[model samples]
Target: MTRRSIGIVLNGVTGRMGYRQHLVRSLLAIREAGGLPTRDGTLWPEPVLVGRSEAKLAEIAARHGLTEWSTDLGAALARPDVSIYFDSQVTSGREKAIRQAIEAGKHIYTEKPLAETAVAATELAELAAAAGLKTGVVQDKLFLPGLRKLKRLIDGGFFGRILSVRGEFGYWVFEGDWQPAQRPSWNYRAADGGGIVMDMLPHWNYLLEELFGGVRSVQCTMATHIDTRVDEQGESYAATADDAAYAVFELAGGAVAQINSSWCVRVYRDELVEFQVDGTEGSAVAGLRHCRVQHRSMTPKPVWNPDLPNSVPFRTQWAEVPDNDEFDNGFKAQWEAFLRHVAEDGPYHWDFASGARGVRLAELALQSAREGRRLEVPRLEVPR
Candidate 1:
């Protein structure tokens, strides 16, 4: 069996999502599994962690027992041996670095909300296409166990003639006054390219389009519920970004979707994220890890009585979907697929064009909110 090592320059991996999800759980986990298997043999990802702080990068390398670490991104990008460049940087900082990487002829993978605006995201996609460099953006939710099960049900015609989708997502992010902030301070600053709409709408865009149909129109309302919040340094700052967003989307097949995302809302659901789909023949609710289904045959019949308490056990009516297959970390699954796409020309559907489309949806939704009216979402065309 032949073995090949693929050198990857990972930028901004010292951050929270970069460190925990992409580096520790995804890349390191893949390395621990003896790398990814390919037709040629095994393709091992040799990652060189790159960040702004030398101390932080060095500490992470030591903690992970990794040999390669660098504080200089330009030098890392200039290296001939590195074939791939991965970025998980702050939204405002991603464009320049990604552009340079594409110029350096490196295949690129990046976190979502590719840019602050759809135009910039589309420009990046066009640049990568012109350069003939492979590019991808993170769409991790599609690979979730529950979503996979939901997909199976959809494919099997379990939810015949799907009608509408409702998604509830969020958890309370403590303000830094009493407890340390759960998220970075920059997430509350509009100038820093932070907002719940920009952060989450991209995920919903792809999810709605992929699972149901293309989004044709959107109506939205965004709010900054908390105007003042203490920062990481214990100093109070004006929160300029939207903390919450309520959006309604009309899909191509006449399906409607309502998704609520907030950073200030308290959790009451079984999971941090949950999506309920209602259809003609059945219904299904999928959380991050669990999925429940209720077919027309097994649905409960209940009679409403205003004067008396309901006797029906509403929660017990739906049947839990069995976990018949092993589920891996969603981030790691995408990473492996991307590596294979880079190494052996494997099939990969989520490309830069797809990422641009996600950004376009967010842009349109924001416009809809600002105008206080439903707006049409035009399709984003990418050159082949």
Candidate 2:
């Protein structure tokens, strides 16, 4: 067994996602699983943790029994062993770091919202392409168990002809004055590239495009429900970014999707986020871990009446999709996929250009909100 070791410079390990998902769950898990399988042998990822805080980085490294980590990104990138650069940093810092990675000739993988805007994201894609580097963006939702099952049904013609989709995603992020905020304070600051639109529309774009069709237009409205929140330092600050966004998207072939995302709404649903897709032959509601379906034949018919008491076992009508297969962590799956792509030239469709498109969708949705009208989405291209 020829096991090859390649270093991945993981920037932003001090952050929430980079630490938990990318570093621990994905890379370390792969190491525990005997590395990523390859035709030749296995490709092992050696992580070079990079972050601003030396103390925090050191702690993470020590906790995981890892030794190679540094506060300096340049030095990390300069290492000959490092071939892949992964970013999960603040939105503002993403473009510059990615550009530097590209210049360093590293294969790149990064968290979504590839850049603040479509232009920057497209530019990064172009730069990566010019350097002939393999690149991937984290499209984690498509790897989720529920979404995977949903995709399966769609592919198997269970839905017949997909018609429309409705999505609800949010939870009441506690105002830090009463309780410590679950999310960081920067999430509510626009200048720092924080907002529901920038954070979530990218997710919606990829999900819709991959499952149903490409989004063709959008109508959106956004709001800042809580203007003030206490920061981690116990200082109060105004929330300049929109915490809530309601948007309706027009997808290719005239499919419609309406999605609401917020950090200020109370949760009264089955999951933190849920998507309901209705088609000609059937309908399905999918959450993070579960999917339930109601075919046309099994769908209940309710008679509308203002004066009569309605007693329909609506919730019990849909059948729960069984766990036909064991699901791996989504982050780990994507990481393994990216590593395989880099090492063996395997197929990976989610490139930097796709990330750029996700950013473009967010941009247009924000514009649509500002204009108070629906706007057409133009096809974005990254120059070869």
* Regions of model 1 farther than 4 Å from truth: none
lDDT of 2 by residue, 160-209 (tens): 88889999999999989979999999999999999999999999999999
Cα lDDT computed for each candidate against the true fold:
0.92, 0.94
**Model 1 lDDT per residue over 269-356, tens place:** 9999999999999999999999999999988888878999888889999999998999999999999999999998998978888888
Cα deviation at 158, candidate 1, in Å, is: 0.5
Span of ten consecutive residues with least summed lDDT in model 2 = 375-384
Clashing pairs in 2: none
Q: Candidate 2 versus the native: TM-score?
A: 0.99
Provide the lDDT at 51 for model 2: 94
Model 2 off-target regions past 4 Å?
none
Q: Provide the TM-score for each candidate, comma-separated.
A: 0.99, 0.99
